[model samples]
Target chain A: MTGTAYVKKIRSGEARLWPSRRPPLTRLDIELTERCNNDCIHCSVNRPAGDREARAREWGAESWKKLLDEAAALGCLVVRLTGGEPLLRDDFGEIYIHARRLGLRVMIFTNAALMTPGLARLLKDMPPLEAVEVSVYGMKEHTYEAVTRTPGSFDAFRRGLGLLREHGVPFIVKGAVLPATRGEMDEFEAWAAGLPGAAGLPSYALLFDLRSRRDGRKNALISSLRTDADEFVRVSRRHGEEAVGEWRDFCARSGGGRGGRLFSCLPSGGSAAVDPYGRLQYCLGLRHPATVYDLAAGSLREAVTEFLPAVRDMRSAGPAYLERCGRCFLKGLCEQCPAKSWAEHGTLDTPVEYFCGIAHAQAVAAGLLEPGEKAWAVTDEAARTKRRR
Target chain B: MSDKIDLDRIYAPSEDIVVREIEGEIVIVPLVSGIGDMEDELFTLNETGRDIWNKIDGSRTVAAVIRELAEEYEAPAGLLEGDVAGLLEELLVRKMVVEKE
Candidate 1:
């Protein structure tokens, strides 16, 4: 072999590979564990870091590897390892390696509190095709620890982030909006912008969801920690005119109601999630007992092919939902989905009033609605015509 | 690096990379370090490159691959040898292709 031929370098966008035809499954979000080192004030799911009962209940390393194998065989190209913090698991490296060996790109979601030198070195050697997302509570010790509720967690997070930086492992930081960290938004944004590999603006979790396990006490704490509608709109607009313009354009293009169909917002097919305990659902948040399939009793193929589509096709028959959410054109603007509803109301169809208020506030701010105008009252024909034009 | 692509050497695609053909084009995704160049996470092959890549079966020597290409395509054996050697050199440097024992 002897001449100077060239290998064309390409970006991911330039390649028409992986799911060139939408395979039945392309992405799988695997919750490695529900445990976290930090007891964040607004977290929806977090078992104690040393909860042996929860640890005992989690599927073993081999079980997870089998699931990853099944997922890869089904044409899954990406597997996201997430949790209260995925790094808490002892065999995180083994599971991560298994997924990568199967040719599935791994994306980790962690609090960055548990990122060690060894883990960072492993990531550097075997890059996680997608960026590891780290959730940042605050920039200062007082504010950060206030949200995490763990003494010395701010320093741990910083030390972990430093290790990732030193080892050249690609990662991005995100923030949560709480009374504790609200004042530090500007600083957080500035720091994130300066960090290498941190793309665009850092996104914040403003409207917190209740626990998937439906812990009422924690749910109440989460509810109290959530930003008000006006505050959400104000904070969101701080991203500047370009972002607001993009939002307006998106609202115009997506203006419509889902009617009685509960899962119309979801993609037609090709995605599902599996919890740490081996229950598979259409998404991580849709933990409704009726919707989740027990993978312990069935295979991944059976769950995705037969069980998931049925759950996705579930319709809302609740009178309240039918009267409001079923007819609201701002459904596209709202974050009120079946999973959110289930987390908040213990039902798949009930409208979350907080989400409804936030959506309306956003709509009004985007100039899509009038003051005091309810979205459900706006006729679809009128809303469509107005938005489309 | 050019001297590394010996005519009698058999080369195979490295185990650290995943290769897939999409719409007739071959895309290579590097699984380990030193394979993908900085920020160029994906590498694609042109028609000529694909032809050469397909012939590197680990069982065939560089000379055999060039001879096979010469018979299939309307090119001189010397020119085909140059093309084969050039591609294998680049792949070798990037660790996308490794010399087999």
Candidate 2:
């Protein structure tokens, strides 16, 4: 079928061929709270200025428990707790324990300023606590604070990282690649690699994209932070093939550090994401009306094998949807999913140019595209290496 | 490297197999037709392998599976135990099964 038709069918009601047989080993991600302390330039989930009180009024502890139990029974081995900042929720620790007791490994993606010694100790005692991912906005206070727009955040984040280290909790640090921080890229990677458990860990930079923020506005800081493609390629090359390989994989899947497409993304039917309100979605990027479900009422297995797949087929299986995304060789490499789709087309399948630019930049650096070629060139040397058997 | 298996590093089936239990066997079908297609590829375990697997399931002590295998096989108990242990280690390395306390 044509890409547009394909996505439509999947979105409409086509069952995902794979997940229908067995429950997923992974639950799509669940957004713990929309309450984030940092007004990051690229935050799609950050509550809009007028809606802060409304959002907080909507979610609470009881809602979290109902969703957690269902996710556990669905056989999700990992649950990534995210938010405006998950730690902002007073009940985050309780939710973590609930999921852990159900045998699910917990990974917290946070800005790190909220980490405390006591929390570190508490986490240290929990074996299911896998890794805490901290996002470093920049290498220095001015640069970091410019992105976070919060003075002294860098210090708080540093102290938080230190607490986790002293307590022996496993944590990894990542950074955003923006105009303000681009010059400090190497220094940032050096800092990430120096963390306690960072050996063999490759620090990655998420490109500053307009789609992530859900607004067409591009931050001037982002413009200046854009790294030259050749420079990134040269720097990544010096770090050895392994480091570059990790970045390459990160691009292919979730730019957020979760195992991306290689594991199971939208098309693969291996994951299901539930929002803070218990609405089910295909991926973190694409939130839709029909695709969403109330976790309080139905069987997760039924949702996965039936309802979820039909939504995927109907929404994303069509050529109109596929014309922008499905055919791109960079499809796997691009982070432009339904969330991005909403940002650009107000729908789940349309492509956004900001992601196109980021992918193009990486494609060029990795030598997957000709110097001036706009379309993705998947047969290039870099593509060949990335697809290594 | 001693016969003592570290649970984190090893994933072994819980039990041992015999000729009678060999009724069904599972194999991983590697799909290497081209690159960029690596995903979980596991097959079913036959009855014999299942018996051996049950013994090695991590809950039972090593001697129990050995005793069970020995009784079922009617073979020399000592040699069979060694063979079963070796086979379990192989499974551990392959990640076909896991070890727990």
Candidate 3:
């Protein structure tokens, strides 16, 4: 009742309800592997070396195909293949081909270390060669390798990207700005722009709090190295001009509220995340049972339509749970959605303070909020205004 | 399958969401969240299906609706029934409405 009223009050300024008014999902994100050559400090799926077999038992290509088919049947137009490294799988080419043949645009997210001339040629031969995005950790060998924690990974990725370019395959570069790579943002952006097919030279920043693998010991290394709120704002403000004009425009228009960059409307439940093991999830970072759904043996559409209402109901009743986040103005800017809640607090709504701080910092950098504005004040005013109106 | 629907039972999405033609595909969005990122999995009704979906307001009986549709669209009633039935089944399954039967 409170959430319903809360949503109604906040959405009153607008002419219609949120989320329920948006289109349902037409995209699927496939995590091809948890195995990674590099043990990054902020990775969520960086399984221990000894747990390789156990992790492998979780999901595979066959399961992936079934999920992809279900997504396609539901009118999914694109599938972004990701993970520790999707290229580690020998059958990556086959899977890409299969999805493309089904009329779905397929994208790959990888470090590109394992990418070879052969794989490049295979992708170039395919007609639906959607852009390949590679994650560059840092500018130099020492800094980049330090973040990835893998020796020689930088050289491998560089060569791999070159192979893709020489073969005339479309690709772009994205970078994670850990403390090690923070200073190299400009260099990485310039290098990415110079790459073939990278006319726009787009890049991304990995929010510190979004490290799903926070439980891992190695993540601690990068966790401490993560960009702090005040400093993060300073860096963004300093380098904001480097972002492409369109991206900046998009960020400005849709960073929050009705016209922001949110993938789905909050609280109204327009979309959800289906995990690697076929469990329906409210967010990718959450591991709780309540937000999980079994999709192993049923119609995908039926499962979503039937089970989603319950999940939405539970999330709607989360004020008793998500106290800190429920009142935060940075809910839109922060990546602390239901999945992130599960990862950090093992609940659907609990707030991870780190994300809250990061969002405020980013907002200040983007000039969405004053530099000294307290997050609580903003949330309180918004809440008070909603109650009064 | 009944071709007519009861408009009273069908709940239309609120006015803030616009369902429009985008290059051939129907693009539906909250009046607030414009065309979303293509990567976010926003689904839309295809053109042909969108045409049929607009008619299912749940006001007409299955038989009467089909007869009207047959004459208006100049298609055979039998052929229209199969497509209409399939579409209705999908719409019903989405919790867009409940069937009387």
Best by DockQ: 1
Candidates in order, TM-scores: namely: 0.89, 0.66, 0.66
Q: For residues A188-222, write the lDDT of model 1, one tens digit per residue.
A: 99999989876789988988988878999989989
CAPRI accuracy category, model 1: acceptable
Candidate 3 structure quality by residue, lDDT tens digits, A309-379: 66655533455333444444555466666666666665556656677677766655544457777554563
**Candidate 3 — which residues are off by over 4 angstroms?**
A1-24, A48-51, A127-129, A199-201, A209-219, A240-272, A316-324, A362-373, A378-389, B1-101
User: Tens digit of lDDT per residue, candidate 3, span B36-66?
Assistant: 2322222355444565656655465556656
Clashes of 3: 19
Candidate 2 docking DockQ: 0.05
User: Candidate 3 deviates by what RMSD?
Assistant: 12.7
lDDT top scorer: 1
Candidate 3 docking: what grade? incorrect
Give lDDT: candidate 3, residue B30: 28
Candidate 1, after superposition: displacement of residue A112 in Å? 1.5
Q: lDDT for every model?
A: 0.82, 0.57, 0.58
Candidate 1 clash pair list? A1-B84, A1-B85, A2-B82, A2-B84, A2-B85, A2-B86, A3-B82, A3-B83, A3-B86
Q: By lDDT, highest first, what's the ranking? A: 1, 3, 2
